[model samples]
Target chain A: MTSASPILIIGSMAFDDLELPTGSAHNVVGGSATYSAFAASVFAPVRVVAVVGDDFPEEMLGTMRGRGIDVDGVERASGKTFRWAGRYDTDLIHRTTLDTQLNVFASFNPKLPELYRDTPFVLLGNNHPALQLDVLEQTRAPLFVVADTMNFWISGEPQILASMLRRIDTLVVNDEEARQLSGIYNIRRAARDILTRGPRRVIIKRGEHGALLFDEDGIFAAPGFPLEDVIDPTGAGDSFAGGLLGYLSNQQQISALSLRRAMLHATATASFCVEAVGTQRIATITREDVAQRVDQIRSLYEFGASTM
Target chain B: MTSASPILIIGSMAFDDLELPTGSAHNVVGGSATYSAFAASVFAPVRVVAVVGDDFPEEMLGTMRGRGIDVDGVERASGKTFRWAGRYDTDLIHRTTLDTQLNVFASFNPKLPELYRDTPFVLLGNNHPALQLDVLEQTRAPLFVVADTMNFWISGEPQILASMLRRIDTLVVNDEEARQLSGIYNIRRAARDILTRGPRRVIIKRGEHGALLFDEDGIFAAPGFPLEDVIDPTGAGDSFAGGLLGYLSNQQQISALSLRRAMLHATATASFCVEAVGTQRIATITREDVAQRVDQIRSLYEFGASTM
Candidate 1:
């Protein structure tokens, strides 16, 4: 990994065969690690600690390295890479999973390299909480830690999820997952309930409604910029995590302002992700472009009073 | 009338008796007519065209008069006023409806006064489509027409609602209402669906997530300013309409800039409305205070970016 502050992302990096409106696009290099690493690297040089297989194309690896992403910890083994196929209807919100091949992902175990041990930022993508906790155990005193979980983990291993929640600095979850975890229909109350578990901060993303940031002080919201064309929403959550952690790692301090700015950047990144299928949209995001688009969003909110 | 502008409001004026942890308040004068007329009168003279009854309370009538709301067209017969009673759990999002009293509101008809027929602007509250159409029939070519509808109308009287949708220039609906109306689960599609019906513009308010504006050209979104304590959500929508139309009428321009600015003001006013139960928090609202809070909201979405 480069000498810059390392953000070790322990997640998936593989192929996403999408069955989109215009039919199928095969074996696009996707996975949370791919999306998040690109996003985080945009702000800080990142180390991806995940497993891939021989079938995983070399072009994808070359792409990450060219972007200044350190994939040395991305262990390459035998067999095939993880693959996911999904379709979006008119709802786009309610996507149906067509197929999931957990190839090399089945026996995946992350082991950070010696040079990456000092990595200060860590993002644990949705996985078995035991696996998440295992990664947490291996990492050094991380400057900031954020873990994402889903209903499967919450239902399958409640106790393990609870342990993982207690150890992290923040938990990023969808609104439904938040409700299922909190047992309350209202997301606001779900946020309050999640706070009781030990994490100082909680961010509940409302799909297209944008995302919410809730800490000890209160809740601040960042709305998703309205896009008429959002072809795919697959890696949106990972993209958000990348943007959030990327901004945080790029900052000098971790105050409320820093966190809030991070949230905004993450939100803007997610906005672009839904514009086209897969990672093609966010693949070329630059800080200048993100900032200018953020200005447009901010302009949508500016107002002046009438003295008359 | 103080002559700032004549405001016409075609909406419901009902009695909401809510049971909160703090205590229970009974038969309070609430609804779009009550809140919009009161909220708008802060900037303009208002005429409320809503149905009520003898049980609608003389004290409430005096209160409207106190606020300079012309309740001359508030048809008062010898029936009951619409009464809604809800009980909130610790998590305030899902409040169980303990009671719903559709009293005189069942056969309500909006009859505008002679002076109100010439009012420059109309703020339609969440009401029956036919009633809104009836009020629209009486008014002349208004400079600005703002409308609000609920899920009930979108589902039950869709045919009638679609017909009414053709008349208004702008629509203000909560996110669920937009989804229900559009029949598309994806938010951008939902906005497109509503725009298809006829209104030149649409604003989908996502409660605490802020609001999204959709028009023919494209779309924009504004984030909600976070608030610490949200005691009551009643009248927040109406207050939003009041703030939005109040600014629109005073500025005398319905450009995208003004509409967005009005949106922020409306969002800010709604923020204050949720601070206390019912309309208590909005009673003391002033334009000056609104300006300062609005600046705070503007600063929220501001972070200039340089080329990286």
Candidate 2:
């Protein structure tokens, strides 16, 4: 294995109040940055840059630090931390957002620390496009940049998102967000439209169906690992992005082969995320566990080539 | 190439009135046997056993005969043909059934001819459980038997469906039917529950999402061919089953590898079915066309084995 580079993650870190059919949990640690950091840390060092309130626990930061995640870039301000409350249906596929308290995250302005300015890999977690662009501007000639966005930012910050799209090398979004962003129902056409807008590569994450990677080379689909039960699905998409970039950071160079393999790793990590609430499963799992799951996913899609 | 064996298909032949998002078509020739016969005819000889009314067009049967699909088993009764009218949602994912006139189909009792009884491969199309069982009883020592079912029969004829399931080698149903029949939301679990019931193999079809095959060998997933537009999805499932059994009949022996490769052909054929209102595309396409689409579908899921 090559030496792994640290991935800079910029987004929010907060507490989630989840009402799942299996049960409910309050003050669960979650958020784009939090989930991404834990997932990425499994394969490489992670640098988190986000703001939390003084009410946030220092022990969580210590836990991350123990896992080789740098928390020096994390800003702790005066106020309650960002808290989101959501309720999931029995199917666990759809959820309704019951509340959102931005708290210190409302004024989140990600500032790259001096030591983090030269990080070669950056993961702009799902956030406002302007803020993502701000981090991109601060980076000094990064080797790769992957930005994740959602419907809220696509509609609210279209112009800025467009600008961010041009700057980022890869754009990741869920299936619904891809359609909403491109105004196209067909995912293939949507990815084609997004390619013209800016990003050279688009990864559309479909919850249980699996994920598709569209690049100049061609399309590669990774089958989602079949889980008997899902405890939570709060940060599956972010965890996928985290694992993708995390695995890519260890590669000698990013190529079509590398990207496709990275997607398999991403799929494996995301599968573990949904097995437990928040990042419980991802945080506790080892690299070997991920590799094993990767093999399972590969077998799921593997078949002999058609000779007819 | 191995010499192909003829496949005996039993189901209904009827007239369909479709209201699609793109347009509308009235008096369209369709039904389970019709679609399956056309799709399977791409690879092997297809013997169709179905019931139609005197109002059915004689030229339609002539068309099937031209394609190497035997229509001697098709019964022409003295009544109007079964007619169905449905309107699709704008997304084309859901539809509202406007009308259903059972007509002659209500009395469909499949009685395979003596010649068809010797056919080694049989495809039991979606219909009442009793009718499906009636066809199964008529078949001699068959090398393989594949059956398709729907929700109406599962809910209405549980005992009969259970009996039929034990007699078939393979059972094919869409994702919804799998869940409804097994009473499990998770598809993997649903398939597991189905495996205990009787059939050695269970194929869960997820329309645009592709299809999954589960058996004693484990599981194999075939990605759905990405289409820019789907004209109509009326007979895609039947076409899928038809192509699957068709390709299987041409194989020297049905093993894990053959079954997996057959799924690719099935996916390719089903992709073409949705390109037109009824079976237009599948009926017109040559074997080479289906092979080319199979190659494309294989690429959609092909990737390097993970070394990380």
Candidate 3:
């Protein structure tokens, strides 16, 4: 377990304005790579490959470096960083995208450092499928490769997404995106159809309902922790992916048992991610906090079998 | 377990026209009591108290008698039976109510047989909350009483529904209805708020995501079986209620362990109910079939703990 390799993560680094029912935060440090790298750094060494702008704060990078995350792959351009604005509905499930400015990320091309090329565990964060594929070509054969996508890529870049899907070991997408990708409303059938495209496993993230892992072995339904207050849900999914890959990178083999444990850890991390705007809660959570939440999750769903 | 009391079920007996993506069935046997009784009869003796019209088929009554269900409490009126027409969307989750002809059921009153009044277990099937309260008044103090309601009653008869809620042992409602009833979007919070109203337990059913049991002790999440083909989802909720109350009636005492098993059986029964229109699959399913599906559900969610 201690001999696991560092995890390579590539995606956008942005400043986001989020409006939630409870409150709102503007120009906060938020991005898929930032959230995933922070979450994964808790379990294993992480190398983040993303582009930011001159406008991006220095303290954010310092925070990542302080957490032992390698920032050598992060590139700083002359313009403003990626920016996004969104608002969550009263239910906190439906979110509206107010605006999205790609900025420096619009023409960004990830150049994996020589050191990151040998990283055994790679997480291709939510980005253009073409860009994800480009990163895939740069990295050597890794122990595992997991790719995340959304409805935009599934609909806009179907061919490139399909090509990228064929090369990844795992595909992570939310339930709605899964339905859109497979053209099947039933999640069980949708996951099965996606597996035919290539990924050995498909993880469908159902925010409040929890996550489901579908593979050849079988299906695993993980329970989502019930939260009394969720301020913002900006980076929960990315955090989930980070926790999962981080835990798996530490394992010698990814067995069903291991994947289940990873799912729980992922669930715990994502729970914290939504507790505040951006990654405030997840950024400060100790391993002990995660362990306690995992224990709570176990108790929430555990039921002893009765002799019939 | 053998000394368990019979279950008293009170609701409507209707003819339904169901249109799903796969196919459609017209004037089929349907109703909360009909579905619940058939599902409950497998576990315990069921006494159904409902109203139907002259057009109601004699064979349907014979079918109940054939399954060992007591129908002496069923009242015969002069007009046509209650009829409902609904169409399921492609997702099979959102359903459109095309027509609802209450007919005889509009002014019907449930006059329980003297024998049924003494039944220890009772299920107040989905109907007018006022009617459910009326039945509650007629019955003696039962060991357990479970009431099922829908959004229609929650919106139309909030005061009566609230009044009825205070007298029941458990409340079974789908996720959307739970939110509407509690005026809270979070299912966990909604269930918690419901417990304050009266029922000791609240079961929030999330169609594809499964069900969650919220009580004073804690929450227990049960996974829903994944079905590739769902012909019609008309009676799934009522069938779920039937399976749960039926199993509980057979237990000496309803413990959390027993409740979880009951949920599993309910889930399995509901799974079969949607396989075809109305109660087609549920009517023919044996206890062995339910047992097998319960086992499958266990395996679907079973995950071994890893030493992290």
- Number of the predicted model whose TM-score against the real structure is largest: 2
For residue B230, model 3's alpha carbon misses the true position, in angstroms, by 1.5
The CAPRI quality class of candidate 3 comes to medium
DockQ top scorer = 2
Model 1 lDDT, full chain set: 0.80
After superposition, which runs of candidate 2 have C-alpha atoms over 4 Å from their true positions?
A: A304-308, B304-308
The digit string of per-residue lDDT tens for model 2 on B90-167 reads: 777798999999999888777788999999989999988888888888888899999999899999999999999999
Interface Cα RMSD of candidate 2:
3.3
**lDDT tens string, model 1, A138-185?**
888989899899898888899989999999999999988998998866
Rank by DockQ, descending?
2, 3, 1
Candidate DockQ values, in order, are 0.27, 0.62, 0.58
> Pairs clashing in candidate 1?
none
Model 3 agreement with the true structure over B49-150: per-residue lDDT tens digits: 999999999899999988778999999999999999999898889989999999999988888888888898899998889899999999999989999998
Q: Pull out the clashing pairs in model 3.
A: none
**DockQ of predicted candidate 3:** 0.58
TM-score ranking from best candidate downward: 2, 3, 1
